[model samples]
Target: MAPPRAEWLASSFACLLLYGFWGFLGKLALVRGLSSSQEAGLEKLGFFLTLPLILKPSATDPNAGPGLMERPKFALLAAYMSGVTAAAADFFYTRAMMKGDGGAVSAITASYPPVTMVLCATFMREKVTRNKLMGSFFTLLGAFFMARS
Candidate 1:
């Protein structure tokens, strides 16, 4: 069965708020002279601490998800790749914040879906529909305007 729309909406809102605060707080930490990227390193360490808690398996859980150790090697590898990329992205984003406006940095970087779409199209043979093309156009358009200000 599909999840309820309200649940999806709430989750999306929560994600928006969490990411917004992440950018704000990361920039603030840099502004406060947390130099040498130790602050960003702690942010990555927090992800490490949360990963186990987030992936803990439960006997009575409805999904019957696999624990970290039980997951397939491929899945584990993929997850590790994602984590490494995220850590790199966060480090660069924090570094950018040290020299750029947080809002503009986020606005420009968040418009990266177009690149993803193109890569998936070329690499994974994904279809690029008209709607997605239009959306990508508008995303870049808005990002351009945002960066100008």
Candidate 2:
């Protein structure tokens, strides 16, 4: 079953807000005394604090989930790749924000959904709808306008 449209929109918006703030917080931390490792440690601390609130208690079995030690090697590799991508994106974004026009850089980066959609279509055999094509066109237009301004 599909999620309600309003719920999907609300969740998307909330995720955007959370990541936006997270970026800002990370930048601030960098400006202050935190080294990259220290920043990562702090982020892990925050995750530990908040994860319990977000995860629902299991109805069938309480302690059935894999412990950190029990996670497989492939899962660790996947997690490492995820971290690498995140770090690279964050580094480039921060560099762009510092050197380039902030509004333009942010506008272009905010258009990532179209790129993601295209990638999904290519790799996951997802159908590209007319609406998605139109959205991609507008996203490119917005990025172009921002870059030009």
Against the hidden reference, what TM-scores do the models get? 0.77, 0.64
Kindly give the stretch of ten consecutive residues in candidate 1 with the minimal lDDT sum: 58-67
Off by over 4 Å in 1: 1-9, 58-63, 67-70, 122-126
* Candidate 2 lowest-lDDT run of ten: 94-103
For every candidate in turn, the CA RMSD to the true structure comes to 3.5, 4.9
What digit string (tens of lDDT, one per residue) describes model 1 on residues 1-149?
56659956998889889988888887888888886288788877787798998776767667576666887898789889988887788778877888888899888878888999998999889999998999999999998988886
lDDT tens readout by residue for model 2, 45-82:
89779988977666665565887579798878978998
Error of 2 at 123 (Å): 1.8
TM match of model 2 to true structure:
0.64
What total of clashing residue pairs does each candidate reach?
Answer: 0, 0
